[model samples]
Target: MFDEMLHWPFFDERHRALRALGDWADSALDDLVAQEHAGGDVYALTPQFVARLGEAGWLRLAASLDGRLDARSICLARDMLARRSGLGEFAFAMQGLGSAAITLFGTPDQRERYLRGVMDGTRIAAFALSEEGAGSNPGEMEMAARRDGDAYVLNGEKTWISNADLAHQYVVFARTGEADGARGLSAFVVEADAPGLSVIERIPVIAPHPLGTLRFDECRVPASAMIGAPGDGFRIAMSVLDVFRSSVGASAVGLARRALDEALKRAAARRIGGRALADYQMTQDKIADMATAIEASALLVYRAAWVKDTTGARTSREAAMAKLFATEQAQGVIDRAVQLFGGLGVTVGMPVESLYREIRALRIYEGTTEVQKLIIASGLLAAASHGN
Candidate 1:
């Protein structure tokens, strides 16, 4: 619907190519969904879905040759996939997030050992940073990793982990130093089959995928498994989030666009009061608001991505703003679509009903809307203080 934005200054030929590839991948989404449904196991279906993306070479966009992430490309990929299928977007996002620490901070040997398998979809990856008590505050984490003679022994639990039981390796963060809060945390690559590592329980969310809690009981990994320095875990996590957060906004924008499209089609075709719903001034107003919100969201999302791509500095403020606005607004747009559809909206097997469920978790995960506001406000206050 908003094809003009594709030609905007923020994007280039490569992004267009990526979008084309996404369109090609989307052509198979129905079959993919059918296969996943038939299998009736989200965890098992994930690898097959990822393998197809890898075969199609779309997963390569998750990481670049120089080991740096391209925010614009990631945003475009998520935007396109989310529009077609939420599961497709999830698969693409986890592949990048699961190994983001290694891509950004791992040694050459670490990258050589993990990145290749991840890119080819031979090995699944997961990021384990959040604990039961530390979903939003990493500083409150209790997971411990003690140094041994030549390895680190880890003991603790990570909850709400995506690809938990299915991942071959995890980028696990745990308290390692004597310092309290974030400084005590360290990041390590812990294999799923590690002696003391096991899935504690599977977590079922409204929109289901492979999610679960992991427990570590004296899990030991080689000293070389550490991503950076002992106290670098928090920084690594934030850096990775800085890159992916804008893409979350992009995905929101995609979802909003799809909602708008559905609303428009319904308004034009559905008859009401002896005329199509589009004839009503109130319906027109709703459509206008949805379109405006979607466009503004797109601008903010891609602008954040563009800034990150052109400048190496972390776009924390921009990313936060984008994610906060896009996700919040997308929820409103989808709700409006549901409203426009009336009883049909909530009916089982309806597209809008499915979308209504899918759009919800975006606001909670990665970072909640409340957390994004705090990040933005803190950044502004810091800037003002510097000016004074």
Candidate 2:
């Protein structure tokens, strides 16, 4: 059903070819998912998953000729990955997210040094921006990067970071003190094993992921490692988010679509008072809602991707709308799926149950639903105030 979406004007022949991502993910990802749920280490599996994606040539899509990412390709790839395995999706998304800074703003030397490893899956990359004081409001982050001759000395703590302990390198943002709040921040590529850096603690979340806190005690990187000019971290981070936010929505759609498919299958199989659950008007209603939400989410996600790919304009409003609507609605859709499955829904190993956990985080990350609302409203007000 999702493959049919490629026919929309939002996509082209190149985009349609990406449907092959789903075929590969569906077949290759299940055994690995089972292994993880059975207590295999998630962090341990990331490299393998990434390596597989790289070997299969999927990771190559994370890059581009003009150094500009294709938003539509990204969204489609994520949709397929999330549908098959949340952890698989995480591995793929982080590659794009982690390297996005370098791809967008780094010097040629930076790109040459870092990007090939990412595309080949020999090294893992992470984006470290969130801090204890700056999850929603990044401007309040306290980490500082002090210029020290030929290098910058970093000292602070970053929490709730993805790929924390496992990533080979991180693109870290810290205050360079050019100004207060977000304006003062700068981005640098820091190796995971840098002398003064350590993975402080691994965080356990509702889903299986490599999340942790990182501490930088006088951690240093060469001055040449800075992604962009001083005080450009905030802009660079926002630009990266603008590129990936719509892909986040596409991931949610994938999760919700999987949930909907599971519910539909269960409805056809489960007997209720001598009739299959699908025969009930109540069950039909739930299925209707789930399908509608999936359709709507896919529409918003692809529309945002289309706008980004076509206009070369900033997609703040479109991406926020897509992320907000798709994530919020997918939550409801998955809950309905769980409801349809009864006890099996809550069972830890079940597909719908796993999806239930996976979908919850989508609402919170990649700019929360509240943040998206603020972004959308702020854009409208800004445009209206100028009479645009």
Candidate 3:
């Protein structure tokens, strides 16, 4: 798979090893699909998928060999899994995202409790940041975390939370006080079994990833559950997003490549007007454009991953650029692939159609394309004015 494209320059031997692991995923995807079909239980299937990944030691690729959460590893894992199956990628991505706060800022005790589960896939992880009223505006979150004796009582509703009903724990965000917008907020690690916490509703999307609303009604936890410090949730969330957003882009690249591969195979075999579809210049142009876009998106996505891994930089701007460009370009490539496939593209269960739906959410999640643009422009302007 790595040799099939020109976007590999950003990767190293470690990344190649991870890419090779995709062979196991490709071989086993049929079994996974069959099981999901027989059971129709995303919650159960997802955990098993994670466990399988962990048992193969592929879940360890979500972090680093030394146990640090390396950004490049996360990117490569997402890319490979996404190429094989969207659910596979979603399952891998959430483990890292749900546990990122702990990996980055947790105390030794916190890491031992959370990171172990994440690495071993014994526990599923989740990030609960988006509220109905505060989807894009963090300052608008109404969920309040009030101090009560030695514990913090969390009261808020978080909707569209990934792995909502399935996750064993969540890194939840809530406002501690109203000192300032986006400043009074704090992050906490809350157990799924925590009192007053419940899965209010399950939201189904075109893809089969798990999502739902979580209600924290006087949900209380020890102060030790707080990540970083009170009034620091906004910073922590942004820092975590910076690391994972690029991987979202990389996933998009993988999906786009799968679409392109399907298109190429179909075009080479299908005969139209007494000739193969490949004989037509129009078909050739579409293939060329799709291939170019795929490579370009992959480069941008992995470049961001590489920058974050090597320099340990904040990478907000680079990640935003990657997510923004790669997602947009990937959508275009998928659209072209569907066009190339003609009638077969829109057919249900076809790889291109599946990818079309799968790629749409990546643009919205992790930070929307518009949000990424604003981030990039704001950073550019700030850098220009500061001359640093």
Q: Looking at model 2, which ten-residue stretch has the lowest summed lDDT?
A: 59-68
Highest lDDT against the true fold, candidate: 2
What's the best-to-worst order under lDDT? 2, 1, 3
Estimated TM-score per prediction?
Answer: 0.97, 0.98, 0.95
lDDT of 1: 0.88
What do the candidate models score in CA lDDT, each in turn? Answer: 0.88, 0.91, 0.86
Instruction: Estimate, for each residue in 1-388, the C-alpha lDDT of model 2 and write its tens digit.
Output: 7867888899889899988888887777778877866767998898888998888889877764347899999999999888888898999999999989999898888888888889888889999999988999989999999999999999999998899999989999999999988999999999988999999899999887999999999898999989899999999999899889999999999899889889999999999899999999999999999999999999999999899889988899999999999999999999999999999999988998899999999999888999999999999999999999
- Give the local distance difference test score of model 2: 0.91
- Residue 268 lDDT (model 1): 93
lDDT of 1 by residue, 78-148 (tens): 88888777777888899999998999899888888998888887888899999889999999999999999
Task: Name the candidate, 2 or 3, with the larger TM-score value.
Answer: 2
Q: Which pairs clash in the backbone of model 1?
A: none
Please report how far candidate 3 places residue 295 from its true position, in Å: 0.9
- Please write out the lDDT profile of model 3 over residues 84-110, one tens digit for every residue: 878878889998898888878777888
